[model samples]
Target: MPLLILGLLVWSVPHLFKRLAPEMRAGLGDKFKGVVALLVVAGVVLMVIGYRGAEVVPLWYPPSWTMHLTDLLMLFAVALFGLGNSKSRLRGRLRHPMLLGVITWAVGHLLVNGDLASVVLFGGMLIWAVLSIFAINAREPEWERWQGGSVAGDIRLGVITVVVYAAIAGIHYWIGPSPFPM
Candidate 1:
């Protein structure tokens, strides 16, 4: 539990620091990016170790209905994730579509998996995404909508979203814990 909590903090704090402490990041200058990268790598390693060894305590069982919700939500999440880096008009409306996608994905997983490990991992991610969105908004108050996103780009994003989402689902199925109900 300690490791899990530590990993979550390690993963999120560096990201939060840039928004929360601009002066600190400025003081660090160019090295700040390198520090963040190291922290992320360390955090990922800690999370992998902690999650693998952590005791599995069963929480409430998710209903079968949640699986359906997961399918739909994951589709939306991936599309939103793509929108984050895309020049689509849809991206213009969202301040941080990637973080929002993370929140969506985390919430969907939390709903479907009620074990202690799942709760810690997914819940921590959800918290981090929400906090990051808020911190980013606070840091950048001005919003400028991107102008003239071509319809072709939007269509291309849809194709990419479907292909990527399918690949992710296939990988999940191949590895284990198939998201779909048999």
Candidate 2:
């Protein structure tokens, strides 16, 4: 639980700092580009280790079906993540693809993991996603229609995301405990 909380704080604070504090972000960006990268990487590593370590204690078990549903939702979450990085129609439609991706990932995990630690981690992420979205929308000016890539590019990104999602799902059991019972 401590680990999970710490990881959440580490992960969310740096991300939010940039969003909420532009001056600090700019100063850091200018003064310590390498340091920022190191901090981000270290923070992510700690978060992953802490999250996996904390999962050992199950606060509660969700219905068996939720795992399957989570798997499906994760596909969309990953796809949104990939699409968020690409200049696709999806990005054009959703001004903030990364926020949408974070929302999807957080919500998906929340459905599958019922433990207190998982709740805190995913819940924090969900809240951050919502707040970040609102902040971006409030700060940025409304722009005209997005200049989406060619239809072919959209198709390519969709295919790539699906493949990446499938590969991750296929390897998940090898990386961690199987979410579904055999």
Candidate 3:
């Protein structure tokens, strides 16, 4: 738990620093990017180790039906993630597709995982994404939507979304706790 909290802080603080302390971040210049990258990697390692070793303190048992909703949410989350990087017309409509995807992913995980570690991990990420969105919006209120997206881009996005989502599911199944509902 301590490690988990520490990892969350390490992961989130660096992300929030630039937004919260623009002058400080600017002072560091481009060199800080490497440091931030290292910190993020370390944070991820700590989080994985902490979460796996943490005592499983069950909070509430989610119903089997919630898995369906989780699956649906995950599918949408994947699509949202793809929309963020794709040149699709829909990409322009959203201001923060990646953060929205993170929020969706966290919510989906929270629906099926009702434990202390799970909450700390997923809920923390959810808070981080929401905070990032707020910080970005506060910094820049005006949003300039993307332009020149074509139908081919939308088709590409759809294909990639499906492939990535399937790959994620496959990885989950290969590792532990199969994502598919029993």
Candidate 4:
């Protein structure tokens, strides 16, 4: 749990730093980017360790039906993630699409997995996403709305999103938990 908490801190702090502490981050300059990257890697490692070490303490028993809901949320999450980085008409309408996707993903996982480790892991990420969005909004007042983009890009990206989502599902099953229930 402690390691997971530390990992969460490591993952979120450097990201929050630039927005929360502009001057300090500026002072660090180019090196700051490297530091943030290293911290992110270390954070992932720690979280993986912590999560694996943590005992399973189920908070709530999820119904089998929730698996369907998780699947729906994951599809939208992946599509939102794709739209976030893609040149699409929908892209202009969102401020933090990727963060929104993360939120959705965390919510989906939380809905299905109620163990202590799962809570700490997903809930921590959810909080980080929300906090980071607020911090970024506070720092940058003006948002440049999407101008225009070809629908073809969106279509292409949508196709790619489906493929990537399937790959992720496959990887998830290969790992431990099967996001796609049998």
Candidate 5:
């Protein structure tokens, strides 16, 4: 849908701006962060509105087994998202943990959702994540690996991941069709 496409563009453009046009983004300075945040929020709103309103044009029906894989991937995605911010030893394992989480989430959703709107939403996010990874790597080739985090940090991350995952599942249940397979 047009709104969905527009939402994707609105969300991605601000994110890619700093990577693509460093000078222009830098010119705006820290103040630009607020503007970018607002744009991202608006983009999410548009995407939700578009996705809900779009007609279901199914491309292919996914196998029932895909639901299990989707759940597994979603759990891993949540862990990766928490891993990025946690002071755990594993923090250094991946340079772009949160972006990787996004990729995982998108892939998981794509596995179960074969409709046009879902593809446009999840697939667009996948493309954006890949592009973002490429852009970040091109800009900063060197990475300083993290060190010296204790196991306690990992324990904390695990707890947080569980909480967040439950919250997400709750939201999905509250909204409409639940993510859980019958």
Candidate 6:
């Protein structure tokens, strides 16, 4: 749990830093760019390990039906993440697809895993998503118009998202403990 908390702090702080302290981020980018990259990688690795380790503790059991719902939500989250990186109509409509993705992911996990660690991890992410969105809106007063791109790009992004989601779902079933273990 301590490791999990540390990982969450590490993951959230760096992300929040960019939103809360843009000047500091810029200075660090200029001064300790390489160190920053190393730290970021280390933080992500820790977060992954912490999350996986924490999953061992079953704090609460969700009904079997909820797992299906979680899967669907995760798929949508992946699609949102994909749209975030593309010039799709969904991106323009969402305005903040990346943040939406984080929220969806966090919420989806929270519904299925009711353990203390899961709550802490997913709740922290949810808080970060909300705060980061607020910070971004506050920092950037001017609304930038969404980029217009070819429909082909949108199709490509959609296909990629579906493929990646399917791959992950398959991997989860094959190598990981059943996420919907009854």
Per candidate, the number of residue pairs that clash is 0, 0, 0, 0, 0, 0
lDDT of each: 0.88, 0.76, 0.94, 0.90, 0.94, 0.80
Question: Model 2 has how many clashing residue pairs?
Answer: 0
Clash pairs, candidate 3, are none
Q: Give a tens-digit lDDT track for model 2, residues 129-170.
A: 898887766666685656767777688788988898878777
What RMSD, rounded to one decimal, does every model reach? 1.4, 2.2, 0.9, 1.2, 0.8, 2.2
Which window of ten consecutive residues has the lowest lDDT sum in model 5?
143-152
The TM-scores of all predictions, comma-separated, are 0.93, 0.86, 0.97, 0.95, 0.97, 0.87
In model 1, which regions exceed 4 Å deviation? none
Q: What's the distance in Å from true for residue 9, model 1?
A: 1.4
Cα displacement (angstroms), candidate 4, residue 39, comes to: 0.5
Of models 2 and 4, which has the larger lDDT? 4
**By TM-score, how accurate is candidate 6?**
0.87
Off by over 4 Å in 3: none
Question: What's the candidate order when arranged by decreasing TM-score?
Answer: 5, 3, 4, 1, 6, 2
lDDT of 6 by residue, 57-146 (tens): 677887777788888888888998888778676567776788989899999888888788788889988998988899999999777767
- Global lDDT for candidate 6? 0.80
Candidate 5 vs candidate 6: the lDDT winner is 5
Off by over 4 Å in 4: none
Better of 1 and 4 by TM-score: 4
The collision pairs in model 5 are none
